[model samples]
Target: MREEYEIYEQSLPWILEAGEIIKKRIQEHTEIKRKSSHSDVVTEVDREIESFLVSKISEHFPEHNIVGEENVGNRVSSSPYLWIIDPIDGTSNFINRKKDFAISVAFCERDRGIFGIIYDVMAGKLYRAHTGSGAFLNDVELNAAGTDGSLENELMAINAPWGSMEEMKRWEHFFKLGTQVRGVRNYGATTMELSDLATGVLGGYVQYYVNSWDYAAGRVILEELGYKFSDLNGDAIDRVYCGGILAASESLHQQIVQSLKESSKEIK
Candidate 1:
């Protein structure tokens, strides 16, 4: 318990400090590089912030394994204590000068995530959680008691690919959910969307493909707030690869999962 709390205590400060670094670079000109296509990109600032975080973590916890989006070195470690990081989650949004970008950091032991932190750099809101400890938005605790129910009356966030015709081949089931909900949102940033879901600002989130660093931290925080998580096929989140993700209340999660299953059969 003491060790867990120590990890939790130091994470917030490091994340907040990273946020400050991100915010300071918002106006300065930075080179952007296309990773695969024009839509998928990275920035010099992303690499810089990631390097800064890796340095800090190595200095403070050399024994811990580090996996970051920008720099993963040559080999991947399967250490029991691992740190997964997305230095700048919404690089496209950041380069486009949107405020929805965020920093996500998660500490996990094997498959169990111990603590997670997501900081909205522009909004100055910090979302954090530790195993068995409730999630918090800054100093305020987020729990089922504090959440607004009325599942049908709530809004949800779906990945952007679900919004189009050509891209909706596999995610058409997800698009159908958007029609039934009160409303739907697409922030193009996983951590930012998940932060809103944990706070009840958004009711749920569904993403067809997301990496460990993309949703790792937000997963811990959301599940702690009584949100359920699974793949579209209703499997546990795969911590290593790009896994389809769904998060919401139990009823909402079931509703979406069942619909996806039924949809697949209908198509066949």
Candidate 2:
């Protein structure tokens, strides 16, 4: 366990080092590619950054497992220490030079996330947390705030592509809650959206789909700072690839879940 923690400590410098590499490449002419969907994007920089991170990690900790967003088959090991990497969280924004992308890394043991780091390369912001240690933005610690559950006064972050029948049903419920809240925002980057929630920049974030690499680090950080994280139905979130993540302060999370339950009944 001590050795794992040391490895995690060693991993931080590599994460920041990779972030510098990404920052340098952000301005260069890079090839953009589509993956899974037009909505899902990737870039040559993403692959390069992932490769750089993997090489550094392997050099430092040869036996550890790695699950990188670009390439995963070669480095996966059955070892307890696993590193999850999203070379660029908002590849579209990165490819287009929008400056809202991030590098996300999480260290887990036997499927339990132990430490997480999300580095906003352009903004020079690093959001990180360990399992028992508290969450932090850069060097300062963070604490979750707000108690008024009035939907009209809350702020929300949601994705833009949920207009289908199934999605609309969910949105109607969220919209009802939105009417009660202050407003809704779309950040276009899931890691940043989750970090916004962790840092209290936004009250909550609701997305219909997200993979493990998307929220793995943010989940641990937010939960450490008195925030709540669960699926839309309010079930405890499994640490794998769970879609429909609903994250917010404890009070707001309950309200959002209750509102969704009521809306579910109405739709039925």
Q: Which stretches of candidate 1 lie over 4 Å from their true place?
A: 72-78, 145-151, 160-167
In the range 1-268, model 2's lDDT, one tens digit per residue, is 6775676677788888998888777777888778888867788888888988888878877888888888833375667777788889988878665688899998888668788999998999999988777788899998755665666676688663555777676467666666767988876788988888887778888887788888888887887787778888888876766688888878888888887788768866
Q: Write the per-residue lDDT of candidate 1 for residues 1-268, one digit (tens) a residue.
A: 7887897897778778888888788899999999978888999988888888888888888778888898743124555788889999999989886588989888888888788998889999888899898888889988662333554687888774634666667666776777777898888899988988887788888887888899999988987777788887777765555778888888778777877787667765
- lDDT score, residue 102, model 2? 90
Error of 2 at 83 (Å): 1.3
Ten-residue stretch with the least lDDT total in model 1:
143-152
Error of 2 at 68 (Å): 2.0
TM-scores, in order shown? 0.92, 0.91
Which candidate has the top score in TM-score?
A: 1
Q: Give the runs in model 2 whose Cα sits over 4 Å from its true position.
A: 72-74, 145-149, 160-170
Q: Locate the minimum summed-lDDT window of 10 residues in model 2.
A: 72-81
- Can you give the lDDT of residue 80 in candidate 2? 71
Q: Go through the candidates in order and give the C-alpha RMSD of each one to the true structure.
A: 2.2, 2.1
